[model samples]
Target chain A: MSLYIKYPKYLTAGESCVVVEFADEIDRGANDAVMNLKKYLLTQKDISIVECLPTYRSLAVYFDPTVVSADEVINAAKSAPELDGEECASSFTEISIPVCYGGEYGPDIANVAEHAGISEEDVIKRHSSKSCHCYMIGFMPGFAYLGGMDESIATPRLTNPRTVINGGSVGIAGKQTGIYPIDSPGGWQLIGRTPLRLFTPEASRPTLIEAGYEVRFVPVAEEEYKKIEAEVAAGTYKPLITEAK
Target chain B: MELIIRKAGMLTSVQDLGRWGYQSSGVPVAGAMDLPALRIGNVMLGNPEGAAALEVTLLGPEIEVKGTGAAVFAGADLGFSVNGKAVGSWRSVVLKDGDVITFKGPRGKGCRGNLCFAGGVYIPPVMNSCSTYIRAKIGGVEGRALKIGDVIKIGEPAALWKKLEGFCLPEDLDPAQDANAPLAIITGLQEDAFTEEGKKLLFESEYTITAESDRMGCRLEGAKIEHTEKGADIVSDAIPLGAVQIPGHGMPIIMLADRQTTGGYTKIGVLTPLSMEALVQKMPGSKVRFRRADVSEGVAEQMRIKEAVRRAKELRLSHVSRTHSEAPKPLFGHFILTVEGKRYEITCEEI
Candidate 1:
């Protein structure tokens, strides 16, 4: 399969890492390029390379400068085969996250509805209906930075960030929406919370959602949330994962 | 052998080189703030450079050596003592079972100190690292700082080389006496985001280290750096160690060993490895200035220091003879030594 994608501009992150910029804006194409390059680089298994961190519009390649130079990494990355549309489209895991909205679970649901000029039910429907792309995982471990939030539900972050937001709290800030993997200080407007474990150090794969995966929130009742939370606590609940439709 | 903590002072924790290869998974690479000192202390005891050592911050822990072993203290002179007798820094000292080791508050310019045992601390490795990432509660003892009544096991002692016991790092290798040393910086990922004036201000002005500084980053109180466009926010990208990020409020935060994997603030530059080492040694109110250095220059400086460390290690080894009781036994076919991050194997017969 032949595909033509523009080479990204390489910038130095430090002596040991380089940031490859595909575009200036946070576009889907840029994200795809970043993930594709990261996958391609991993297959090479270069000893000099340390880790590749994929973000919205760029990929940061960390390496040992003592073993390899930035120019060498850039040259290798430039020569990597461009991924075909079908190849890029393949291998996306769709994860269904169970979220309980409104009431104590989401304190800012009414406020979000007011800001978006919609009913509380409409806010939940708009949030859970569309599938969002996991653009990157950062800020905290297993915390997935998602993209593709509906413009109608866009709300501003709290002026004063809360000292602690509970783990699994689903929140939206500006054009982005994500789940908190661990309790942390945050400014995002809370709309809902997931019962599933987004991050656990004990698990073989600590983060449930990886970059480039599709995340869809399924609204559940408060009682169901508690049931699922219990199942998770008992190590019996398996997260629902299916091929992206 | 084991050591029990009698008095856990300030923030004492077990640290090695760092937890690496897990940053992509958002795990902070937590380790000793002063890595050079950690390595020096470990090497002095004939332990691998990456061996887990006790990282004593500001104040120091009072420890009771449960079994006989040799120990070395490196970095800040925290007024180390054994049984009320004063001991010197940067040298290996033989210890007997039931010996009590204690330290006074830092009497020197540096803030952090490292105590390394001959065989290294035998903490279980998490994600392939013995280093403690306290925020995540992973690695080291219960993933937190040492508390009173905690007992840590130490590995088997290296062969006893009496002649090498008193060797110390030369005074020149220690951090410079000036507290306001200029830290070398390489222009970073978001350098273009800052205005020309901002870049000028960074190198021209002096910044005082804030008390909020920790292993995560050094929050500096300095002149506000002007941003040309989005004012300090970014699309959230990987944060390299030593990154000097300017937040919306414009104060620079130099990301360190315990920094989060990625951040949204715009970074103007990153401190050189040596500069990072020097920056960690400074106290809260210490002043700092940034000096521009190219990547090659920074790498070269690191290599130079590594070479110096190699020479220092050789100097200690030269004092050791085959007849020394501490020398590796003939039953052990090989003696493994870590040099400049590479391991070299020497046959016992060859020595």
Candidate 2:
């Protein structure tokens, strides 16, 4: 099931950006045609877009060459219209995510269960069984790159990379996973954490996992991770959402 | 509050001309890494080219003021001074209220500059940006770097404040201030994961800039380039803003302005918002080099720096012979004044 191309290539990311790729393979059908050309260039309000991003199979954009250029964002992304990467995959929104796995919040869960010869409870039951796909949020703010893990609990990533790593911890690396929405300096492999507050930046919508959502995780334990870290610092924990297969 | 820091040199912050629609949430557009010397030092002080100034770095911040405002200082040539009197770099000075100012460090090259103030530098902006992204602390001040006494508040100058002082930057609208020019870029990300001799050893050699460069990237060294056999990682993207990348111990960072909004190596080229505002004013053992441009020469060097800052604010608003328009000869008033009570109305003219 991999058709969807609909013109993508365009490169130049320089004098004001462009990139747009769409597929050189990072799967999920080039990130669902990079989230359907980033929701069709965020509905091209007559093209003046100053940001876009959408990674996992390109998107970048970022315009305003004094108004609009980069050949008008490659002629409005080559006359748009490619759509159907799963027809807005049910206008995305799954959420869930709790995770509290392995001792001391995953110290690389016995090296990812001895590199998958499985045991740490079958590596947390094949990493909280399914449901993942985020495909990019970025390295620092509200992190989240996710994307369906479970390649037999794929691991490998810590060849020495840890000067910090804390905020909502969870990890994985190869075949992707993610979560560390804030402490930083990672290298992945570990796995477990999420007391919520996935980056608040003074609240009112700071970021909790957005890039076509769907997360899922849910495991919780250490006294329900200290009662969902005190109902996420007294704001009454929420993270549950739904709507999407 | 009208500026105060008193001596926070070597890393002053509070920038502007950046922080745009949060890179898909990873933030980090930080701002003012010599963005055309903070938009021509807020277009030589008459403010508004993206206000909130003060970048500095490469040792330079002393400031003191506290009342009388106006300042300008653009990219590099730090020597600056006032209560000690030297006042260099593209005109506009005025300061004076306890004056002070300072900044004498590297007087032979460059390395970030700007200052602009006249009214800007106020603060409180965060998401909509007053710049400063000191590794995600957030916008300016509270987000760190400008310590010493901190004060800083400014904002309220342009009442044509003496035609916003002197205004200079006119040396053929200054170009290659040469901290070793060349930058250019735009080569195409992961250019086939490199190797045509690593794109002829990155546009034929010459690197250097590495005291571990800062504002999130620039780290370089020299000949490494090579890749292909598919190594230097790639599954990451959107680094743009002078990208460059290369990792895998083959060096060639670049990024700039606090970078990292996504990056997993192998970029190859990007540079050109006027080569990242002239390679963030060079200096770190300086010596760059990497030309291959295109994207219409980085959109004609960013429309020739927004047409040299809209022709230096229209030649500082039509040259007005170094400001002096005197014409005040009116005096009339129709009394009716009452303060401590909410009932008063009057009209007058006295200039």
Q: Report chain B TM per candidate.
A: 0.90, 0.37
Q: Which ten residues in a row have the lowest lDDT in candidate 2 chain B?
A: B316-325
**Model number with the top DockQ:** 1
List runs of model 1 lying over 4 Å from the truth. A1-7, A158-161, A243-245, B161-164, B170-181, B312-351
User: What is the TM-score, restricted to chain A, for candidate 1?
Assistant: 0.91
lDDT of 1 by residue, B1-351 (tens): 799999998999999988777766778788888877787777777788789999988888899988787888887788778887777578677788999998867886788888888899998787888988888788899989999999999997665433455667778766333556688889867788888998899899999999999989999998988998767788778888889899888789999889998888898878887888788888898889988888887677567667656765665565443344685554433478999999997744322
Q: Can you give the lDDT of residue A137 in candidate 1?
A: 84
**Model 2 Cα displacement at B283 (Å)?**
28
Model 2 C-alpha lDDT versus the unseen true structure: 0.79
lDDT of each: 0.83, 0.79
lDDT of 1 by residue, A1-245 (tens): 11225447788866878888887667787789898899888888664688898888889888878778888999888877876767667668889999999888999998889999999999999999999999888777788888888879989999999999999999989888889888888999998899998887767777889888899999999999999999999999999999743
State TM-scores per candidate: 0.89, 0.36
Q: What is the TM-score of chain B in candidate 2?
A: 0.37
lDDT for A68 in candidate 1 is 83
Cα deviation of A192, candidate 1, in Å: 3.0
